[model samples]
Target: MYRRIRFFLTSVLFLCVATAFCNDKENPDAIIGTWLNATGKGHIQIYKQGNKYFGKLVWLKEPNDEQGNPKVDSKNPNASLKTKPLIGATILRDFVFDDDEWNSGRIYDPQNGKDYKCFLRLKDSKTLLVRGYVGVSLLGRTETWTRIN
Candidate 1:
């Protein structure tokens, strides 16, 4: 009887450890990948840094402007940063997963050189809903980004 009880407790402990190991192996965030923006003009690679998520533009449909010069963040509010190229710029930053979405992030629009409060939600494995709001969520705009992979 003593051996049987010891064996049973050991088996349960092994199972609990195995379950935790498996959970650690499984990724909690399904949003890590390359995603194409709604306009189909740019591709951003979403990656995890620490406990947060960030996205940066990797490719652009039109890399160069009409003058054949590489597109830049010309409209950036900061005159010192206006010369920075837009192709590899970090457009999304500091997103923390909360509830069913990634919240407390900011998305920058290189076109107008403005930043908006952003939240991200995965509609499906292949679709992501990116919302950028000014004051409230209802006052924002949502864009659908399709996963590349």
Candidate 2:
């Protein structure tokens, strides 16, 4: 009886550890691939920077430029930012996953050279909803991102 009880406890413990390991492997915020902005207005590529996530403009349908060059955020009002180009500007930055959502992040709009409070939520394995807000969460726009993979 003693041996049987010991074996049963050991089996249960092993099962619990395996379950926990499996759960950790199933990360929903594994947005570590190329994604396209399905908003029809522009295209973005999301990539990882160290332990966080960021996005940059890979392509734009209606690029805001006069000479067909990629437009910078001239309307930023910040002299330093207004001169930066749009192509390689870091639009999404410091996105960390919390539970099921990414919060307290910032998104830069190259067209306006403005950074807004950004949060992202995975609608599924392929779809991500990215929101950019000013002061309040309610005052934000949600854009759907489709995984390129």
**Best model per lDDT:** 1
| Off by more than 4 A, model 2 | 1-29
Q: For model 1, which pairs clash?
A: none
Which residue pairs in candidate 2 have backbone atoms (N, alpha carbon, C) closer than 3 angstroms, thus clashing? none
Writing each residue's lDDT as its tens digit, candidate 1 over 60-140 gives 999999999999999999998899889889999999887678999999999898999999988777888999999899999
RMSD of 2: 5.6
lDDT of 2 by residue, 43-73 (tens): 6677777778888777666666778776776
Task: Report the CA-based lDDT of candidate 2 relative to the real structure.
Answer: 0.77
Q: How does each model score on lDDT?
A: 0.90, 0.77
Candidate 1 — worst ten consecutive residues by lDDT sum?
Answer: 20-29
Candidate 1 yields a Cα-based lDDT of 0.90
